[model samples]
Each structure stands twice: as C-alpha cells, then as structure tokens.
Target: MPAAPEMPWLPAQLNALLAQQGHALLLEGPSGLGQFALAMGWAKALLCEAHALGTPLAPACGVCESCHAVQVHTHPDLLVLLPEAMQLDLGWSSADTDSASEAKRKPSQEIRVEAMRKMITFCQRTDARGRGKVVVVYPAESMNTVTANALLKTLEEPPGNSRFVLATEASHRLLPTIRSRCHSWKMAWPADAEIHAWLSAGHSTAEQVQGAMQASGGRPQNAWELLQSGFEPQAWSQLPRQLLQGQAGLLAAASPSQTIAVLQQLCHDVMAMVVGAVPRYFSQDSLKPLVAHLGAQTGETITQQLQQGGQSPRQRTLERLAQWSVDLQQAQRTSEHPFAPELMLTALLDQASQALQAKR
Candidate 1:
C-alpha cells in the first residue's frame, strides 16, 4: 500500500471509483496507463483512517496514521499481490519462503498459488485497525491458472469486511470467470498536451518531453520513466536511418529484448507507412526517410505502388515486414531465456536491415 507514483490522469478515476460501492473492482488497460498506481490509490483510500471515520468519499488523508502505515509498507489492513520479480522491482519484500531453494532458481514472474492461499487466509482475518481490509493485485494476468482459480473463489464470495482491486494491462488474458466476478473499469489515456505538461514539470527539456511522449504513445507515466532512464531523443529519432545503414551499434547499449522491442516498433511503423496509415510509436520524420529509401530502391514511390496494386514491390516489402513481425513476436516469447546477447542483437539487426531492403 505504499504511495503510488503521481499520475495526473489517475486522480479523477480514483475519485470516481471511491464514490462507487463494490466488493471487487478490476482496473484494466494497456501498460503505461497507470493501472497499478490507480489500484494502489484505491487500496490506500479504502483503508485510510480518515475515510473510515468520516471522509468516505475523499482520497487517502496523507497525515492519518493509516496512511502513514501504508506509506511505510506496514499496513496491517492491506495486502498487495504481485509476482516475486515484480515485488523485488517495486521494493516490496515478499513473505519468508525456502530461501535455499529459491536461491537456486530465478524469481518467478507468475503469482503463485501459495500466495493466493495466503491471501484467502488474510481475507478471513478480522480487521486489525477498525478499518476494512484491502487486497490489491497488480498485473493480475500474472496469476497462473491455479492461482487465478483460487482468486476466483474468493471473488465469488468475498468476505464482508474485505475488498479487492485487481489491475491488469492485458485484461483479455484474464479468465472470463475472473472478469465477470469484478466490476471492470478501463484506465484512461492522457492527452498529448497533458503528458507534455507533466513531463516538463520534471525539468525535462521541451524536446525531451516531446520525444518521450511520442516514444511512449502519449502514456504520461511511461514518458516520465523513459526520461528518467536517460532516454536520448536524438538517438531514437536516428534509429531507423542507422538500422537502414546496417549500424547495429546504435542498439549495442540496449539488451537483446530491448533491441527486439525497438526493432518491432520500427517494423510496425514502416508497415503502417507502406499501408498508407499513421505511425503509432515513432515520429513521422524519423520513418519517412526510411520509407522513401525503400521506395527508391524498388524504383517506385510506396504510395504509387500501393495504388497500382497486385504484388508490387511495396506489397512485397510489406510482406517481408509482416514476416519479420512474426519473427519478432516469437523472439519476444523466449526473450527471457538465456542467449548470447551480442549474437541476438546482430541477428536481429541483420533481419531488420534485410526486411527494409526487401523487394520482388
């Protein structure tokens, strides 16, 4: 129940959720839209001593003892469910387990059934602070079949004093029974102007803010994260040209998975341009030259070839990109497995370069 990051788009949603009455709530949307933060805010407000006393419709009173407990991650009335890896990433310590056994394996990315069983016990306990108990589950899709089934039973007949909040970036992946058991709310996407203003307040330059905004598809939380991670706006803008020229060093600093993600974005935008659609991840300026170069190599403008129809070089280029997209998707599925990082990057770069140069 630690305080979530500041996301401008979440306040109104949190307020709206606070005004409602439900035993279970599901906040669903794409990543970078603040689902986890919104879920934490809801859990905090639900357990806030001030809200329990009188201000039932207000957000968490930061000065209250309950709020203080949440801020310190010692809220007896609140439980947060996340994968072990995610718990480590968020700095939340997990319950004691077989350390010797766990030390021999990588941290799990799925919410284990054992955690769900513990949560069921937590639900049955009496409230420790006179306030109702709150259970917040983030990235709820991380719950495997067994774990989700255990949760489904709780949601079906939740304890009267316990409330649940489940948040996920991919709601479609959730069990239909789970989705049907909770009141679902879609996370809001912030406007470009709103995202820009928020990032600027962090002392980011206008150029940096704009670049991050576009790179994250206007997700305010993600844009701020990108900037905080020392994202270089110029390097991103120059990525397509560098790839076209076969300069794999542009992505040498990124991990194999990160490079694959970037290449996927580039492939996506170029495919969009070939099909006469707008790009979603990269700036138009960065992709236009790459598309033009592809067109020139094929001896016709992309738009002209598309208008002429019938397996033109533009269509063939799109086909190559489509196949590359498939390959990237497969790569993403196994990205967590150990691989030679340098070899992966080189192979991915070569595939991307050849896709861009595809003809016939």
Candidate 2:
C-alpha cells in the first residue's frame, strides 16, 4: 500500500532526528493519523545508505542498498511490530461473550510479552547490510505492563547501531520512564474545513455533509466511514422529537447499533449544551427537546455511565463525551444484523430512564 501522506510538519521533525545518529524517536498521535506511514518512511530513510533525503548532517541515503531493503520491508536492520488484533476489550463489558458472537467479534488482549522480546532480540542483532538497525513499534502502548517492563531495558539503552520508532494514541498509558527515554513528536488531526471539503468531493447535501463531519470528530477518514455506512443526518434530525414527544414508533424503529449511536449522540449534545459549546451534530431544534426531556443532569449521568462503562474497572473514566464512546465501535461497524442497532438503543433508553427516575 502506498504510504499514508505525511503530515506537513512531520518531514521536518523526522529529518531533524535522522540528522542525529543516535537518538531514539517516538511519534505519537491518534490511530489512523499517519503515524505508521511516517515511521515506515523514517525507517527506510535511516537504513538507506544512498539516503536521497539526507543532507550533510543526517545519515539516511534513500538510493542506497539499506534504503532499498527498507522500501521493500526486507531490511535486516528494521523490525516492525503491529497489533495482533485491532480492537482491545479492556474489560469494558462482562457479557462480552454474547456481545462478541452477536457482533461476530473477539476482544483484543494486551500485546504479548513474546512480541516485545522478539523485537529486543532483533534490535541486538548485527546489521546484515552494514547499516544501523531500526525497530518500529506501531501502537506502542499495546505493550501491557509486563511487556512494557520487558522493553524498558532495551528502550533505555539499545545497541549503538540500533534506533527505535514508537507510535501510540494512548501516550499517557505508556510508562513515564519509557516516554522520557525517547524524543517525542505530536501529529495533529486535519481541520474541519479540510475534512468538509474531502467529504463533499462526492455530491452531498449541506446537512448530510455537516453531519458526517460532526460524527467523525472532524477526521476525513472517519467522515468517509460514516458516509459509507449510510448514516443519514437528516433522518437522525427527528431523534430528539421522537424521544421528547413520546413517539414509541421512533424507539421501536431503532436498531441496536442505531440506538447505541443515537443515545450516545444525545448524551453528547446534553453535555455540550451544559458547557455552552456548539454541538455541530445535533441541531438547535433537536437540542430543545433533548434539554427539556433529559435535562442537563440526566445527560451528564448518561455521559458518565457510557464513559465509565468503557473503562477497565480499576481505571478512571475519560473526560470526553463521544457518541461512539463504547468499545463496541468496531463491532457496530461490521455487524449486519437488522435488530442489533435497535437493541443497543433500547438498552440505552431503558438505562437512561432508570437513571432519570433515580434522580427524581
């Protein structure tokens, strides 16, 4: 696959690091934010003896034997470690067995310690092509405590000819000692205008376009996912009305995935309203009924529930309120059951109602 386009600032940041021969580098950002691509390119540049991108100060020679091997991913000097599975469970639900089968899924456990040990061993090997060795750890935080501990010694002091490139969305989850040992760079997401333009490349109504951008948190790739899934923003505009006006039809019509999404969206709107932030996903019209029926407290309660529900029992909750707050995002994305969306929504509504009654 072609490399993900580099973030405008990344080339310069990476180039500076490649100039220095011995520094370990950490590239941190959200998943799918081009960190993997940047790391691959960096590895290639490093192993490249003919490093075309290299200047007098840096070591990578793009046209060299080492670079060619890296470009084809056969470089003896580079080892790439990726997730065994994309989604991790983190103990988000006790009934994951049912949820898994219902959604045709499996929860991802932590990165096995064996993977880290293998990486460490690879890094210690002498370079086959007579160049510095590179180890690129994708989703670096996938390392569990044990695996991370296993990696600490290697990360702190790798062989003189070895360099490491680590990537992650959950930077804070990494050991602080591991974090402090490497040079870190942050990659920012694209702007709203950029995402909007990309989504509108195909014919889309103003509202439809706006809604996708909202659903995606301003990421073009995410906006594309929402669009491809046939999530109609115009249709969802009626949700608040159905909730507030006592339309059992609307509640009955939703599927589990849809319910999960709408309830999460509703909860998000309430939180936004309370904080005086502009809620781009839900309109002012929808917000009126939501604020009236659920109120700010109910919204906050549901938001807290969703956030708490997704965390490990011992871990604290996340501060943000997102409609896709549940760990079931990938499950929902791939599920084909017609009733799944409705069931998920109904469960949320029932939970919200119970919370509302308890509040009273």
Instruction: Identify the candidate with maximal lDDT.
Output: 1
Clashing pairs in 1: none
Residue-level lDDT of model 2, residues 1-360, one tens digit each, is 122223453566666766664457788876545677677777777676663333443535567677676666566778876654542211122232355453564444456676777877887778887656888777888888888887788877777788888888789999999999888878667666755665676566767889777665565555665676666886667766655544433446656655555566666665666467777567877677655544433434546667767553212211333323543354455444534555555555555444222221
The CA lDDT at 50 in model 2 is: 65
Model 1: per-residue lDDT, tens digit, 1-360? 323247787899999999998889999988888888888898888888775465456788888999999988999999999998788767776757548887677778889988898899999999999878999998899999999999999999988899999999899999999999999998888877777776787777998998888888777777777888788899999888877777764587988888888888888899988888999889888898889988887787668676767468866778888999999998887776647777887778778878887321
Least well predicted 10-residue stretch by lDDT in candidate 2: 87-96
What would you estimate as the lDDT of candidate 2? 0.62
Off by over 4 Å in 2: 1-22, 30-32, 52-73, 87-109, 197-209, 236-265, 280-285, 295-346, 353-360
- Give, for candidate 1, the lowest lDDT window spanning 10 residues: 1-10
lDDT, candidates in the order shown = 0.84, 0.62
Model 1, residue 87: C-alpha shift (Å): 1.6
